[model samples]
Target: MTSSAENSGQPVFTIIVLGASGDLAKKKTFPALFGLFLHGHISPKTRIIGYARTKMDRPDFLKRISQHIKNTTAPKVKTMLDQFLDQSTYVSGAYDQDSGFLALEQEIQRVEREAKIYDRLFYMALPPSVFIPVANGLKRNCYTTKGINRLIVEKPFGMDLESSRTLSKALGALYREDEIYRIDHYLGKEMVKNIMILRFSNQIFGSCWNKDHISNVQITFREKIGTEGRGGYFDEFGIMRDVMQNHLLQILTLIGMEAPRSSNAEDIRDAKVNVLRAIPEVIESEVLLGQYGKSEDGTMPSYLDDDTVPKGSKTATFAAAAFHINNPRWEGVPFVLKCGKALDQQKVEIRIQFKDMGNAIFHKDVAARNELVIRVQPQEAVYLKMTQKLPGLGMDTVMSELDLSYASRFTNLTVPDAYENLILDAIVGEQSNFVRTDELDEAWRIFTPVLHKIDRGLVPVEIYPYGSRGPKHLPEFVTRFGFERHAQNYSWPETSQTSVAQAVAALSADSKL
Candidate 1:
């Protein structure tokens, strides 16, 4: 089924991991590449290069990467790791200068010897400060003219609309939009990727996914751990820029957008952009910001307590805001995006609360509003809470869920890391999961004014216990958007820490087998 010319023309992939000595490279980037290698997605001839300012020998690099790679004990996996490490080489360099880039390019060309075409995939794992400089250097020095050249960038794209547009212009000067992959790794998530399928493929969800059936939608991102040692970085961006602008907003677009013309990248992105453009600017009154205080257990420190944070810093560790889309599908429907650090729990989910039934025969008994919840992490699931008659003979109604828990239902499930999926997508020239330039610009447009207000002291940052469920006003904040919690307490069994670990371990075991 294969021709010799076609086989010979297969691009020789060269992956250069920028900021290779950084935590992201060790914890996520290298691990993801290794995962692809183990799964036979990466070709044997592919050359993996690591570039960073930190000077480290090959052994040290291998050890750092090995900590994140799983199943190294398995015979086949051991061979793969050995080969992967063998293929991996380190390059120490400054981002701005041409000399370093020239040296790096020399190394790449050496490995790519004899190949007529060189496919270069540069993964920018560094911060925004050096993004432009690095791109300039790569374009002038290392970019291949023969084959496909893809640049994969990580986010915190920019602080707001102006900054995002500026970054886009800078990158646009060096590369074509299709050659640049701006990753919002959330789009690579299993359930997040499933949202389109869940909405478009399923007749049940597609029929009622509008303002009439949905009262309000809430997208929440919670983190249990505080900024351990990254307070300096966290303070610079705060929760809104760090999470909401890129991660949460991307998820919101996917959830709120109309069905695409087709599954093509640009078509899906066009649909998302239409919904984003319809959203008016986020208002000051509708926004709630907060900084975390000490934990209730008294063992944890407050956000300001971190040595790196200024003593009187007003940086918000938590933020909750509501956006109203002016389009036909989501008109008047509030989409609340909430995110926080140092919270009581760690989870991300989207909750779509439907309007309450009017004048029901058992109105008093059926006080619970119908809700469709899609859990994004820590045990992925989707459940709809609907009023059901009590199992007993009594004429009473109770709320229950029609649930699909990934762990329980799909015993053979092997959910890939978000980065792994995105990396593979990048290698295969798929842009659907990556962010488009206009999408980033539109996202910043919706929140720029609110961000300015927060920066200008117009929005007061409330204080909540580090280990508590966020600010005391969280309930009031959600209620204002018409999000109703069932009167009775409903505890999700799999939300606990132990259960999450078990599910993850189960998935890991399945992946190895």
Candidate 2:
């Protein structure tokens, strides 16, 4: 546990944000740092360095990003904003050159020496194209300090397996895996982190979290908004690499992995690697791919229409795959992972399905099943659907949900942002919240073949209208793995849910048209 004393201890650190003026740095990266300050998690002596080509001075940087912070966070965050502003210094420079790195290195030294703490942390918030160059420059210029805890890199880790491997190797040449924090914001989500506790910490889930009692798993990451002017980047990467491989697969690993020997990062990550290593070697015909067509509404942009994207792009906006872990715990059980843009709804979830009623004593006439859902986005909560006796009937089984919502349950506690938790973890040398380099490579390996198929148009990509459940073939997609069109037996409840296999089984039955 991060005790109050630990949280409040040691006030000195030189924290540098390399791409200080970009969208991620302004909207998410900067605000997350402020959140740590607000919650008293960051040390008081932590000095922030904003490094970028943007030739802005301190006053301009603060004024511009302050509004971004406040808009993205609560009004009470102003106190922390003032404190962060006091320590923020703007550095104008390019990422590729040595002069900038030299000047930046001096700035870090000045901060550490002045603040009386020798800790140095550099955060690369720039685009992936610049990650390797900046990383190389940092190794050449900034990694000279002693006893530095860690260096953190944000996600979109790499394009695919090869690129991820190259990036990991490049970074490894700079810092050890433990000394490098690869941030996957989803892994930082309160709900995503809860997956472990929900399974390991609770006996109810721990007992059935294996093949014998559970059936299959579904992890979905969907966004209702189009690329929103990020066409160049979105077109190049698409949903498979952007959403499914890292974020969605990380969630699935949490759900399907055996309990680690210990909760430490290495042990936990080891379990995930084993599962990822067992990805189906045979041709995975069960996978479904797609690009979203323009909406009949005439308001959104289609993949081809986005001028920033290359013409004749084969990139897919939606992707779904049914995979299995060959380990004893989840051997034959299917773990389905799916993600897409322009979805009918905004959602991130894990659905767990328990075995179907072989022969039910109660309401055998009605379909009966039990499921659990852990909803991750829009709102966060858990829901359990099980058969219950209809009040007026003689043991007639009807499905209903028992719900728990974090918003309503934990009053007065606004959970720290994912970046806040992850960044602070990196600051304090806790690797539990960040993914390892091996984990990133393993993640890409699982999807490399499929991604290539998607890129070359070797695999079929069914285009669906914007804001639809995604290719109408989704029901058939799950059926190949023995799942009926979601459990006709259940429907979701409010705050109301997220993801898991049993929950999807219950949901499938109710969703069958």
TM-score of each: 0.94, 0.90
Model 2: per-residue Cα lDDT over 1-513, one tens digit each:
232224345544678898998888888888888878777777777789889988988899987667666543555665567778988888888888999988888887787677765666788888888998898888888874454646788888888778888888888887877778888888889998888888899998888888898877878888897776688988878887788778888888888888899987788888887778877632448688888888868776687787787887778888888888888888889888888888899988887877787766544346555678889986788988677667984756577778887765665588768888788778777787688877777777777887777677778889888888888898788767755533344556453223344566778988995
The lDDT per prediction is 0.88, 0.78
Residue range 324-360, candidate 1, lDDT tens digits: 8898888899999999999988999999999877776
Winner by TM-score? 1
Q: Supply candidate 2's per-residue lDDT for 219.
A: 82
Residue pairs with backbone overlap in model 1 = none
Off by over 4 Å in 2: 1-8, 71-76, 281-284, 297-299, 362-365, 485-490, 495-513
